[model samples]
Target: MRTIGVLGALLLFVEFVGAQTLDSAQVSAIDKNFWKTSLPRHELQWGVGCPLLEEFIIYGMGSDDLSGDFDRPHNWFDKEVYRGSRGTTLFNWSFSYLYRVCKFLWVGADVTYIGFYDVYYDKFTHQKAYINSDQLLTFMPKIRFSYLNRKYVTLYSGISCGIGWVIHSEKKEVNVVTNWAFQATAFGVKAGTSWFGFAEVGLGYKGFGVIGLGYHFNRQNRQLFKRNSL
Candidate 1:
């Protein structure tokens, strides 16, 4: 009876050990798969968005001419020239390069361009004044923090601050102004694997809403491509 009891206890211990080993192996496999499908090290993205804030600023500047007579000398003979203005804003275009430094953090740089044109006219005389065409180019270094990271989706928020070069041209006169530029994303979501589509809600230079496509590659593959190209 004692011998039988010892055999039973040994069998139970061996089975328990086997089960633990199997569970550990399965867990390891799952972890490997999870990391394999997550975010990569390098990403390149291009996008277009409406330059809402910039539009407002440009329009405000355009309206300044309507308030007064473009610094014209007031003449008693000059008819009360009612002034008006019109402008058009192009969509903002951006390109970015990002490097993932850790599981939840990324650093990147963005290049953006915004273009618009404004014209002031005399409403009564039906005569047009000078036309102003302006362009804003910005380079910003940015950081992003991922709050939710998954195999096929990621949710994040980011901020960027930098300087912008404003090129203003009117007829033969050209002016360049250096100014502050920034962007703050409240919510951003990206989906897919090597090729992805993303959308963001933000404020500042990038605009209020953005949608774009991106491609991601690992360091080894990138190096291989460089070698093959050479």
Candidate 2:
């Protein structure tokens, strides 16, 4: 429900927050002298890379149940049982698309996948309870409003929300678990530079906190004097 609202908002236009360093004359001067020439030959709109994303369950509830009667001490037989839902790791990767809604601001739609893997040795059985993980595919479309600063760097803030699905199933003994599916949500801030392109990290609970790193690419254009009528 909330996801839909966020998606709608992201689809709309956004404004960047920044100090008006360029006066009207300076803006016009740059518009005539620099912007028109540079913009036409800037970075390509489409780029592909391994985008780092941090995923957490903003809110989730799942439990495991065992299906067997244990009247005696020998309950650990060659049978099937359900284990409760343990927490998931919040690190993954997503492909990004900078959807330009404003000149300095662009909304990025990220498709991210995170697999929760747990491998531990049982002290009693001396066997491994392979809590094999499920992979989640998220369609996180976010809105970013940024200021391409005077120094030609980008400073931005993003707010995103999306739908999450279990693209790949968890295999217990190479079988998918018959468990209820869980969903998630996220939002964050970013800072860009020349040395490393850009660094984006943020917080939004998906049953836990999310932390991520995204490498910016195709960075070329900087000055935009004219009001982008888009």
Candidate 3:
């Protein structure tokens, strides 16, 4: 499957790319400073983006009720058919923690959830009914490459491999599908000292792009040195 290949490629890419960013001396210094001093150990992020759920749900429907005759209502008490389908990015969140392994390498794990509620109607009897919903939960152990780690700003590239489950309830039947999840690449930048804002774009289960705000609890300790001191 394409997803399987992507998962493998993402793992290899992170290792190869993270390795090429630094030498042994720089890595040693970074590791020494990390354990010898206080540094931020975790990151919590909240964001919103596209779920890309509409098409997938429609495909799963396997009928034209939701797509073709979505607006036309035939009868009630008949076989339950899709009244309509709507996709959204109203819920999305990610949490990750990184331990400095080298100047350019930070290893961590991240978990994320993206969900949306789809409203279904009963052709003629019901009006504006909200009974259908879909949710996706993913857990990824990732590796990040910090190209520039600074007090006020951070630039990084990351990759992750994980599994995701899609949960949906149709009529009275609940269907759950699990698949290989991969983040091909995520390039992002954070700006601020304590509370920061960040934006990133890449291909993944979450979406094609991500934007959010976060708070770094150990921000003060994350700064290895003052910029003015350099």
> Highest lDDT: which candidate?
1
Q: What is residue 10's positional error in candidate 2, in angstroms?
A: 16
* RMSD for each of the candidates: 16.7, 8.6, 6.2
lDDT of 2 by residue, 45-88 (tens): 22122222222342145344344446544755643533434445
Evaluate model 1: give its TM-score: 0.69
1 or 3, which is superior by TM-score? 1
Positional deviation of 141 in candidate 3, in angstroms?
Answer: 1.0
Task: Judge candidate 1 at residue 156 and give its lDDT.
Answer: 72
TM-score for all models, in order of appearance: 0.69, 0.50, 0.68
Stretch of 10 with least lDDT, candidate 3? 49-58
- The C-alpha lDDT values of all candidates are 0.73, 0.43, 0.64
Task: Please state the error at residue 52 of candidate 2 in Å.
Answer: 14
Q: Is candidate 1 or candidate 2 better by TM-score?
A: 1
Per-residue lDDT for 94-126 in model 3, tens only? 656566566567787767787666777756666
